[model samples]
Target: MIDRDALQGHLQQLLEADRFKDYGPNGLQVEGKREIHKVVTGVTASLALIDAAIAAGADAIVVHHGLFWRGQDGRVTGWMKQRLAQLIRHDINLFAYHLPLDAHATLGNNAQWGQQLGLVADARFGDQDLGFIGPVPDGLDLPRLSELVKRKLGRAPVVVPGDGRPLKRAAWCSGGAQGYFEGAIAAGVDVFLTGEISEPQAHYARETGVAFLACGHHASERYGVQAVGRHLEVNLGLQHAFLDIDNPA
Candidate 1:
């Protein structure tokens, strides 16, 4: 077992959580037990994840996404109340890292995704360095790259081909970052990839000739939380398990 305060401190330092302007609070959204034995890490802090963690006898749940977004109503009623009540009743400490988790140099979602795709990250630009730009190795085209993405992420990407050219450079941001496409285009990358796609992005891809790939948000972001969990296991001597709650968005 580990002290909750110590763990939270280490996580804050490890992630530099205070450096980013996030949509919600970054740590300890729900207070639970003082001692944490086993930790359950997942993409989002859904009720199902909480129940699963409780079933696994975990004292804490760590996640990338958590309750209480910026625009959400402050009232604790209905579904929010139920979710919070469950956590309070079970005494599961809820720790969430938002933009910090996505921008970490080594353990961030974009970095992990880049590593998996064999892209050597050369630079990070766009919002708070959330967007990653890197080289695509020789002989990789849109179709071949899409296949590789499918093989690695276990989900076929929503692909929009551009310019009918060999892809040389690419940029990406994991988890619903289609808004960064313009920045990637401005960076002169051959392709821009993100987790989700909007209606307007399709037109941009065609007009700007920058290939766009909508990799599954959940699939793309699975690595960061797991990476943090593994770090806790190896460095902090804590038991960790990753629970992947399937999200099709």
Candidate 2:
């Protein structure tokens, strides 16, 4: 069994909430019973995942993406109504960590991807503090790496080559970050990978001479939430299970 306060506190300490400027507040939201046993972790707090958690008899659901966005209204209606209605009915607690998970050196999406694809490169691009951007491992080109990413992430990448050069330097943010065009260019990364893209990304890829790949946002982010769940199960002696709610993007 896990105490809610203790678990939240441990996560706070480990995730370093103060160090990250996150899209959502880190730590527990929608508090429930003070004592917990079964924990369900997932990428997003979508309806499917929440339903699974309730069915699994989970006291709490930990996720990378939680309910409520930056500009969303406080009113509970429509899709939001259904989601909150289900959770409140079940008395299930929701906990989310966004940027903290992305920035975690050992357990983050960017860092884990960095280990698999790129060698260590000091953990940052420049003044930007959101995610990892660096070089691919030795002697590999873009096409081959794209193949690997397709295999691992189970999706074909939408590649846009800028320099038409083989890739070594690259930047990555697991989810939708088509907005980071300037950051990747400034980092000197020859390529960039993200889940979603816009028209401007195409223009930037052409102009900046940086290769771009859209590899599906949900696919790329699945890793971090699962890793953190397993870590919690091992280190904190909590019963944890990861529920996969597949999304194409």
Candidate 3:
């Protein structure tokens, strides 16, 4: 067992939360017991995740996404009230790392998702600091790579080709980040990929002539936090299990 405060401190340091520019706070959100043994890790700490943690008799739940969104007030009411009620009733600590998980060179969503897609991982890039691009080699056609994406993510992507050419390079940022397509274009990647696509984003992809793929917002992001949890269990000697809360979006 490990002290909750100490564990959060360790994770914050390991993630180097301050190193990357992000949108939300990255660290411990709700304090609970002094020590924790069983931890449930997931992509997002929604109601389903919290319930799974409680059912599994976990001491804490750690996630890539958590409560307290950027502009959201701290007031817990309505849905937030019910969410926090579950945690408080069960005395389960919640640790969240938003941008830190997204930007980490190894365990971040970008790297994990890239690894899943059979892309050779590299350092993160661009203003958003979401993730890095992959060189798909000179000869691989877009269709084959799309199949690979489907194989990895378990969902055929909504693909739109920008240019009438075979793919040479591609970039990925898991989750609702169609905003980065222009950067992918600027980086000269033949394709740009994200989780969910916006209507405007689809138009931009068609207009800019960049091959765009939306694998899934939730599906593309399940690996990194699980990686972190496994690392913690193996390295720190804690009992950690990942609880997947099915989110279609």
Query: By TM-score, who's the top model here?
Result: 1
TM-score versus the correct structure, for each prediction: 0.98, 0.93, 0.94
The residue-by-residue lDDT of candidate 1 on 1-249, one tens digit each, is: 789999999999999998889899998899999998889999999988888898888889999999979998799998888889989999999999989889898998888888888887799889899999999988888888999999999999999897777788899999999999999999999998889999999999999999999998889999899999999999988999999999888
After superposition, which runs of candidate 3 have C-alpha atoms over 4 Å from their true positions?
137-139
- For every candidate in turn, the CA RMSD to the true structure comes to 0.9, 1.7, 1.6
Q: 35, model 2: CA deviation in Å?
A: 1.5
Clashing residue pairs in candidate 1 are none
Per-residue accuracy of model 3 over 187-211 as CA lDDT, tens digit each: 8777888898888877877787888
Error of 1 at 88 (Å): 1.0
List clashing residue pairs in candidate 2.
Answer: none
lDDT of 2 by residue, 98-127 (tens): 888877877887776556554454657533
For model 2, the stretches where C-alpha displacement exceeds 4 angstroms are 116-121, 126-128
Model 2 per-residue lDDT at 135: 58
RMSD, candidate 2, Å = 1.7
> Which sections of candidate 1 miss by over 4 Å?
none
